[model samples]
Target: MNVSIIKYNAGNVQSVLFALERIGINAVVTDNIDKLQTADKVIFPGVGEASSAMKYLKEKKLDEVIINLKQPVLGICLGMQLMCRFSEEGETNCLGIFDNNVKLFSADLKNTKVPQIGWNTIYDLKTNLYKNIIENEYMYFVHSYFAEISENTIAKTNYGLEYSSSLQKNNFYATQFHPEKSSDAGQKILENFIKI
Candidate 1:
């Protein structure tokens, strides 16, 4: 099967590529429209600032191409944030695949950090993406902004308060955490996505 990883000005593309390789899937990393449209599955992975990433996608016109894809699409980290309607990070408008909006974690929280980096448990599993994955399984996360729990939220996580860690709307699936870096459970989630 042809799996294409959307390449942009974002970080962590190589790590997602390698993660797919370990799962025995040889995927292409490209911004080419044809390559993306023809893939059996598309992975949109990002680890970067919101506005800049949105700028690059719009500049390449990939912003339009991504929303129109018929095949299953998986978005990671900032990719997930970009899929939302808007982001608080830079007051940027996003692709709007999901109805929810991304917001910055409050700095006024007593002890927790803004960007919740490191392992966190994901529960309330609600999509095929979490098939076979147990509740409260640890997943690696690194983000300052988060999507509020909405009708599209498929999984939930709590740092200071609860938020959508993963979301699904139609064929689009997204994770605020980096599954590629989450270890065995993460691999399973990726494999499950390939199967879908």
Candidate 2:
């Protein structure tokens, strides 16, 4: 499969590429519009601030390319947040493939951190993305903002409160967690996505 990883100023591209390699898939990292449009599967992974990421996408016209893709697209972390209608992180408007909005974890929540780092279980799974994956399986996460639970939420996770850990709408799928760094279950999720 011709898998392309969308390249931007964001972090985590190398790790995602390595993870795909572990699954025996070689993925190309590029900002080339034509190459991205022609890929069989596209992975949009990021670890960065929202407003800046959106600015880069807009400059490259990748925001338009992403929203119009006909092939299966997988977005991770900040990539997932960018797919939403809006994000509190940067008071930014996003790709709007999913109707929900992203918000920051409340500081008032006792004993909870803003950026919920480390492993967390994801439940209420849906779609082919979770094939052979169990309920409440642990996935690695490192983020302060989260997408709210909405009609498109395929999987949910609880840190400060229950929120969307994964979402799916037609050809697009996203994970708030870093499946690349989540170990075995994560690899299984990647394998499943490839099969889809």
TM-score of each: 0.98, 0.99
- TM-score of the candidate numbered 2? 0.99
**Residue clash pairs of candidate 1:** none
TM-score of 1: 0.98
Cα error of candidate 1 at position 154, Å: 0.4
Candidate 2 per-residue lDDT over residues 1-196, each given as its tens digit: 9999999988699999999999999999999999999999999999999999999999989999999999999999999999999999889999999999999999998789877899999999999999989998999999999999999999999986899999999999999999999999999999999989
How well is each residue in 88-127 modelled by candidate 1, as lDDT tens digits?
A: 9889999999999899999887678978999999999987
Number of clashing pairs per prediction, in order: 0, 0
Worst 10 residues of 2 by lDDT: 107-116
